[model samples]
Target: MKVTLPDGTELQLEEGATGGDAALAIGEGLARAALAVSVNGELRDLARPLPDGAQLSIITGKSPEALELIRHDTAHVLAAAVMELWPGVKISIGPAIENGFYYDFDFPEDAEVSDADFERIETKMREHVKAKESFTRQDISVQEAIEKFKTENQDYKVELIEDLITNEGAETVSLYTNGPFTDLCRGPHATDTGKIKAFKLTSIAGAYWRGDAKRQMLTRIYGTAFLSKEDLAEHLHMIEEAKKRDHRRLGKQLDLFHFSEISPGSPFWHPNGMKIWNSLHELWTEQNARRGYNRVKTPILLDVDLWKISGHWDKYRDNMYFTDIEDRPMGIKPMNCPAHIQIYKSERRSYRDLPIRYSEDGLVHRHEPSGTLHGLMRVRHITQDDAHIFCTEEQIQDEVIQCLRFGFYIYEIFGFEPKLELSTRPEQRVGDDATWDRAEAALENALQAEGLEYELNPGDGAFYGPKIDLHMKDSLGRSWQLGTVQLDFSMPERFELAYTGDDNDEHRPVMIHRALFGSFERFIGILIEHYGGEFPLWLAPVQAKIIPVSDLFNDYADQVAQTLVDAGLRPDVDARTESVGKKIREAELSKAPVMLVVGAEERDAGTVSVRRRHNAGDDDAKLTIGELVDVLSAEVAERRRPDAG
Candidate 1:
């Protein structure tokens, strides 16, 4: 038989030779380093036999496939260590995740794993790695696998195998063995345990067997592994940095927002936080005005009939919050599209009035699971920067491009390079294939025309249409999805929305639903983390802090603040009976972008000392009032879009 290597080299080998044999034929060095092989793009273990006249690529320790194998082997080691420490603990399943691996187990009633057990587990894992036990894969019939797990009293394993056999029509299952430990898995694990050189168990938590709340709770042990010690240290440091910038902590320190038991997933905006909100809203309104969008308001609660007509009742009912209003069902709007459709249908339109862009700061409520709610990232009640564009089918591409450009403009203001994603229709979508195909093609063309690269997320779109998702990466390299543009043919058809064409015939107008800032609460949360509570000059709640050096400068400080306020800036005067140094330190702690120091000399001279928030080691610069305003105005404008360059 002939085998082809990645470099197009062909070697004649015995028919049905294993990948290991092929590697050995290539070179002794490759054979020793080979962890797995990809035969015709399918990853398989070295023990798997290669077909006749096959193309193969041997994967070594440096390849991503080899890294996955190492992580999988580490999970098996972890499970083995747990079972060894506490006899009678039943292993369920272990899988390799993006960053690391985790193993779930159902331990004995009296035995519960905690942080203290991590050191012992780590020691056991290292011992296994040092032993260099080879991983062996075995294939057995479903009935045999079930019987083996049942006999061992491993109910979770048995249950999983039974489901796979019944639902997936599996005739056989694969199991991996290392020394005395065995786990049910479909794997291409590392050649041996020695490959797991740098790994650490990070934390422990409780998880459901299959993520169902009512299912049996299992102990999930999480850990991460890297190819080298230095890489592991760097990863750990990145995690520490992310912890320091966690928005929940910064929100409290900055006094921006808070949550209470009365409203579990809702945010209470304080004065400072509301100031930021108002500024964002003002900017939004100003931008939309330039884009020819008409600002509109709609009812927060709508009757069930409206939702039914818009198809929200059928598709999005699970996430919607409904109430009984005088014995009539009313839903707190979970989205603004249906309400926008209602407004569109309120008036008859002609081709002259085509392409109506309606904008609203719509407050919505969705019933999110309690476990999924985070500080401000995930919440129940949110105000969406919602807009709907109603236009003829021919206008789809241009409208989409315009929306993308608008989204780019918004993200660029925060110094974020937006990542784009195109989501196609789901299996249970409403539109016909022709409509979906057209819509998807239009979105793709628009994105390509704008020269934006995007990832395709199959079957992740709304039921009504395909969508474009825009994500922003923060300082810690975490991506947040904050903008979306969805194309909808279903809503217009369902609502029977039509605009007269040039031929005087009524035709259904396509609808495009879009939001630049997905939710006010979540975006603010991201901004807090992105800027570490030191918002840009334009977005800062208090752009400037006027610090009076002494009580003698109170009137001057108040006048300075008034001048700033009159100049369309949010400024505050600190008149507390405190030392100048203390006031400056407090201003820095509050993350005020600019601190204007007013002393008797500066008061008399109509000048002030300017201190930058992030300049911890810099001296203050003295400037006249006009000069100060000019510098601050530039800073504020730059904060609006410092990355425009």
Candidate 2:
């Protein structure tokens, strides 16, 4: 057999040799360092047979693929350690996630597992790594696998195997063995446990079996692993930084918002939080107005049949909140597109009014799982920056281009570096293949016209249409999806929307569903973490804090604040009768962008001493009251970031 390396070098080998043999033929060091093999662009286990005339690339520890493999191996070792510690514990499934891996186990009631158990578990995991056990994979029939688990009283494994055979039409399943521990998995694991060098079991939580609330709850252990200790330490540091930037904690500290028992997933906005929310919404409205979009409002409670016509009832009824008004079944709207369609159909249109844009801050409701709800990121009620456009098919590409530009403009205002993704149609999509093909091409061509690079995400678009998703990276290097521009041919047809064309013939119009800020609550949550609660001057709830150096100058502080308000600035007097240092500390903790400290010297000169947040040991800059108002008002006007000049 002839095997070709990427460098165009061919080598002769045995007909049924494995990738390891080819690596050995190249060099002993390469063979020893090989973690896995890429055969014809597919990642494969080193133990797999090398096909005739195969293209092979040896993956080493330095390869990006090695980390996930290392994490997978670490999870297996952790499971081994658990079984060694607590005999007779029932193991479920373990899988690798984005930054780490987790294993779920159904332990005996007396096992007494907790975060305290992590230390001993880590010790045993290290012991297993030191033992240097090689992983072996075996392919067995489904019946054989089920019988094997049944013998060991492994109900979870048996259940999984049964489902695989019944649902997936599986005849064979692979089992991976690392010494005494074996699991049902399709694996390309590390050669030995020693490759899992740096790992830590970070936390523990409870999860229902298969995420079914009625099933038995199992203990799930979460952990992360890396190639080197230094890399692990760096990841741990980032995690610690992320902890400090958690929005819930920052929300409490900054007095932004809160949740209560009365309304489980609803946010009760304080003055400060409402300020931020209103600012974002107002800016969005203003931008829509600039683009010739008309603002509109629709009812939140609609007859359930409306959703049935929109195709949300049969597929999405489980996630919708339903109610009975006078014994007639109605639902809290889960989305705004269906309502927007009704508004569009209310008026007649021609080719001259072909591109009619309507925008709204639509409040929607969806039944999210209780466990999945985070402070403001996920909530039962959402305020979507929703907009819809009715246009001729010829205008699809151009309209998509404008929507993309508008989204970019919004993200740019928040200093987010935008990344674009073209999400393809899902299996359950509404439109025909020809319409889908045309919609996909229009979106792709718009991206190409803008000269922006994007990745293709298959089977992730809305059920109604294909979409272009926009993700933006924050200051902490975390990505968030902030917007989407979706093209829909199904809704217009379903709604039977029509317009007079250039030829004076009635024709169905195309619909585009767009949202720049997906949800106002979630966007503010991202902004809170992105800025670490210290929002940019324009978005800051309390733009400036006026702290009088002493009570003697309280009048002067009030006067300073009044002057700021007259200049259209949001400022408040921080008069607590505390020491100047204490007041500064409190103001800074609240993340106030600027602090105006007035004292005897400043009051006599009609100037206020200014201290900026996060700037310590710096001499105060004294500016007259008028000059200070100019500085702040200009910042508010320009929407400058804290670090920006």
Candidate 3:
């Protein structure tokens, strides 16, 4: 039999030769370094044999695939350690994630793992790694696997295997063995335990099986692995940076917002926080107005009948928040498309009025699971910067392109280079084959016309449509999905939305649902983290702080602050009886973009000592009050985002 290498070279090998044998045939060095093989693009263990003539790419320790193998192996090691110490714990599933891996286990009644057990587990894992135990893969029949796990009293493993066999009709299952530990898993693990050069168990949390809250909760241990110690240290440093910029902590310190148990996924915006919200809304309103979008407001609660007509009640009832109005079922709007359709249906339209764009900062309520809720990132009540465009089928591409351009403008203001993604039909989608194909093609052409590269995320689109998702990178190099443009053929049909065509016949108008910033709450959270709470001059709640050098200068400070406020800046006067240095320190800590020092001399000269946030100079430059306002206004008008570069 012949095996093909990545470079397209073919080697004649013995029939049923494993990947390791092929590697050894190539060279001794290659065989020693080979960790796994990508058999025709599918990763497999070194022990897996090539079937007939096949293309294979050997993975080494330096490859990303090899790193994933190491992390997966580390998870098995950690699970083995846990079972060794506890003796009766049942292992469920362990899988490698983006930064690391996690293993879930069902513990004994009296034995619960905690932070204190992490040290012992880590020690045991290291011992296993040092022992260099080879991972052996074994295949067993479904019945045999079930019997084995049932005999060992591993109910979770047995249940998992049974479900797989029942649902997927899996005839045989694979198990990996290392030392005294064995786990049910698929192939593509490291060649041996010695490949796990560096690893650390980060933390443990309670997770329900398959994330269903009603199911029995299991202990999930999270850990990370790297090829070298230095890489591990760098990853740890990046984690520290993320921790330092955690928006929840910054939100509290800045008096921005808070969450309460009564409203698990809702936020209460404080005065300072509301300022930020208002600023963003004002910008949104002004931009949409310029873009030919008519600002509109709709009812927050609508009759369930409207939702039924719009297909929301049937499709998204699980996430919709329902209320009772005089015994009639009413739902808090979870999206703005239904209401926008109502507006479009309110009037008879002709071909001349074909593209009707309606924009609104719509407040939506969704009943997110309590466990999935985060600070402000994931919330129940949110105000979406949403719009819907009613256009003819011919206008789809142009409308989509315009929406993409608008999204780019918004992201560019925040110094973000947007990443685009084209999401196709989901499993539970509503459109017919031809309509879906046309809609997907329209989105693809729009992206191509704009000359933008995008990833195709299969089966992640809205139920009603395919969508283009826009993501932006932040200062910490983390990406956030902010904008989306969805092409909806189902909603208009469901709502019976129609317009008179040029042929004088009524035709269905295609609806394009878009949101530049998915939700104000989540976007604000991302902005907080992106800027590390040091918002740009335009977005800062308080752009400037006026500090009085002494009690004698309090009046001057107040006057300066009032002048700045009248000039369209959010300024605050610090009249507290603190030292000038303390006041300056407070302003710096608050991340105010500019600080104005008012003293007897400056008050008499009608000038102020201006200290810029990004400046490192020790000297404070003196500028006239009018000149200062001009400088500050220019900075704000420029709409410079935080230094993402």
Write model 1 residue lDDT over 1-645, tens digit each, in one string.
998988998989887799999999999999988888899988888988898777899988788776667788899999989989999998888888988899998889999689789999999888898999989999999999989999999999998898998899999999999877998999887678887779989889999989888988999999988778888888888888778778899888888889998999999998999988987898799899999899999998999998998777987899998899899999889988888888888989998897999999999999899989999999999999999999987899999999999998888778776899999999988879998899999999999999999999999998889999999887777888889999988888888899989998989999999999998888888888888787888888888999998999999989888878877888899999999889989999888888999898898899999887767698989998888878777766555543342
Backbone collision tally, model 3: 0
| Model 3: per-residue Cα lDDT over 296-352, one tens digit each | 999999999999887788778999988898999999999988888888878899989
Model 2: per-residue Cα lDDT over 85-194, one tens digit each: 99889999998889999999999889889999999999999988889899888999999999999998889999999999889999999999997899999898877888
Q: Give the TM-scores of the predictions, in the order they appear.
A: 0.92, 0.92, 0.92
Query: Poorest 10 consecutive residues of model 3 by lDDT?
Result: 636-645
The segments of candidate 3 whose C-alpha lies over 4 angstroms from its true place after superposition are: 25-32, 61-64, 83-92, 105-113, 140-173, 208-218, 326-328, 426-434, 458-460, 614-617
Candidate lDDT scores, in order, read 0.88, 0.90, 0.89
The residue pairs that clash in candidate 3, if any, are none
State in Å the error of residue 359, model 3.
Answer: 0.3
Collision pairs in model 2: none
Candidate ranking (lDDT, best to worst) = 2, 3, 1
Off by over 4 Å in 1: 3-11, 24-33, 53-55, 60-67, 108-112, 140-172, 208-217, 640-645
